[model samples]
Target: MRKVIFYILISWWLVACNSSVISPEMVDECPPIYPDYVGVTIPATIAPMNFSCLDGEYERVDVTVTGGKSGEVHVNDKIVLFPQDEWQSLLKENQGDSLMFTVCIKKEGKWKQYRPFPMYVSSYPIDYGVVYRKIAPGFEVYSKMGIYERDLSTFEERPLLENTMVPGMCLNCHAFNKTNPDHMSIHIRGQHGATLMQIEGECELLDTKADSILSACVYPYWHPSGKYIAYSVNNTRQSFHAVKDERVEVLDLASDVVVYHPETHELLLSPLLQKKEVFETFPVFSSDGRKLYFCSAEAKPIPEAYKEIRYNLCSIDFNPEHGTFGDRVDTLIHAAAMKKSISFPRPSYDGKYIMYTLSDYGNFSIWHKEADLWLLNLQDGTKRPIEEVNSEDTESFHNWSSNSRWFVFSSRRGDGLYTRLYLACIDEDGRVSKPFLLPQENPWEYYDRSIYSYNVPEFTNMPVELERRKVERGIVSDKRIQVKVRQ
Candidate 1:
């Protein structure tokens, strides 16, 4: 009898161990995960999108990811932490396929399984990296800020320049020529303010403010030929709101658009872009460099009539060889007639579409909570909001990939305050997929703890390389090349 009882006890212990493996009891609702990665499309080269359960009831969790063409990954923890090597291998093997995840949680010694979800991995490859400014989303005062570049294929970020390098100064508006990091431009504001340009791997500091121009260059767009840069010189002002939803309002008291020729050190001014009654800003050169697109608004009274300001989308002809503007400006989209204002007119590299932000009023859509992305189809001249990638919160400052298959934009969708970078894929038919948050190793932890917002998220074909100490010395030194206006 004693021998029989010992054998029976050993068999019961074996059964208990097997039961702890993954014997889910009931089919419960889907597991609540941070970042809401469900049903989103992702690039195969992107980093692992680590997530955690928002519900704290689970004591233990198991996630089983099965790639359609690759092996399976089994992770056991309260939070899903994928192995980097295994995740990369899985994505490689399952490109242009789907990954299904089955999440099972243990609560009070009972296991429950949720409905499985799918994450499609697109075959379309994204840019190698992205560069943007990391600053506190605040009003007037700014603390420590820096321009950072992150590799999309991995979780690595390095600063190109920071405020600590030059104390009491602010750096912003970094632009690249056709996604070429070797040719870039950035602005520094403070006692030593100048536009820093890198051409073909050489750096030069220039004072873009000429005697005729209203103010220094604020918004910058490089010409495809690399000989010229289109800029907007604006007399900008700021105001604060007493309401809770609205905190600040930034408007241009006076503004105009101009092009700068680095080779000749001359600033090109068009009478149409610089008018007393009109405000023209946010100029961008077309992919072929034959036209310039900008935003135009009727000048209104200062902060008193700020809510009545609305900008219309307009374009003008450009002669790259002679660096001259056309005789007449053409109005593309009459945004004011539609009770909307447009800003940041970014044309795709393929020249098929132009994407801009549309708000109820004003050019500073970053502070406008109703701002969303609008796409203008150049082929049919039809425009519509990209509802697939927009949320109820603010969506501003977007850029397209070199191949025009992906776009990165900044949105205040996470917590409704800090702007985070998001990536979305676009098909040949101009259909945008649901956007996913810029993947982090630990998205929940990183996003929750971060205090800075990602502004001006732009894609780059290569990493931005700059000497930190050299840039600091150049900014501090009073050696600036003065730009002259073309007579």
Candidate 2:
């Protein structure tokens, strides 16, 4: 009855879509598409790269995807949509090659075909998903926010924990050891300020503030061995601008970097990183766990001299077994010499390069319109701006994929205010590719009405399994393990 009618309708729709497409008048130029997937390389496991015509006046769009492996898919509709199973199958069959895209659009009953483009398929596989913080695009107060995990293979996102668990709480950036969820850490700020630590699948809430430190743990990065976690504690303050171009400036009155020994419940101190005149933050363990990389800027007067604060890409030796730092600090890339600043120095897991954010001045590059991405070659010590992936807008808070062949970064490129997530590829020879926006089932509609901004995107090898009920109780109960041992 109804079931047979539904099946027959579906069959007819498919046939119509498959048979109704006609040869269109060829044009010389390419179609201007949203997301601009043109010439972008993607892994086989990524979600379908669905797109639509940027000019919405079109009556319909016809897309033909053809790969060198003798695979093809056609769609004729208002917006181009590919069948998920077929898209996956085609991508899998075309690894290490490219697929051609021929887009034709019908506007007011006439059909015209644009020049074809190519979508590269990389042989390298990406991580399972990414974990990030989603918060309202404001700095004064955090009304609602959460740490979420998204499966890259699909458009599925689930929140690990939301501020609703305990209202007025803020969830800062989360970190994992080599993309393994077994070792994770997140900083919670508010009345229930604490650091949630998970080591080898065991989770605990820790009051990470100590009398000797400037403040509670803020930014976190885990050592590969899981023996130590590096953090930067800062006495931070913010100021608003009266001018038109600038809005906010985050200046650290004082900051220092330290390492935490999970097994011993101790804080490893290093005076080298705690100099009174030097402000240090954004600590990360290097690829082999033998070095710790961080950002350092000469401390300046509060808000008056904030523009002079610039951080350099620096590193210090570390002994993972001993949970200790080297005596001397090295300035890997001194931005002050060039009158520029660097922040968020993320070294590739394969130890090939360090990608960082550069601005005119100040360590808080996210608020700087001049902020852009720069790459430092580890082997030769030469550095340059990543022009291919950078835009005229701010690019901040980037992370490397587990495979080191891909990277994800936060950019305010589209409209210069709403932060969006984009992913790009960098090959072994230091060649970079144009980045594509993070995929959505319907990107145009999703981004237009979005109020929240994506920040601190991190790749995870697998989905993070956390028990929200237990965590809510832990924070509500106000019980936390002190990082410093009891007297």
Q: Which window of 10 residues has the lowest lDDT sum in candidate 1?
A: 15-24
* lDDT for each residue of candidate 1 in 93-120, tens digit (9 for 90 to 100): 8999989988888888777888898888
At residue 133, what lDDT does model 2 achieve? Answer: 90
CA displacement after TM-score superposition, residue 220 of candidate 2 (Å) = 0.5
lDDT of 2 by residue, 249-327 (tens): 8889999999998988888988898888999999998899999999998988877788888898899999877677788
lDDT of each: 0.90, 0.88
Q: In lDDT terms, how accurate is model 1?
A: 0.90
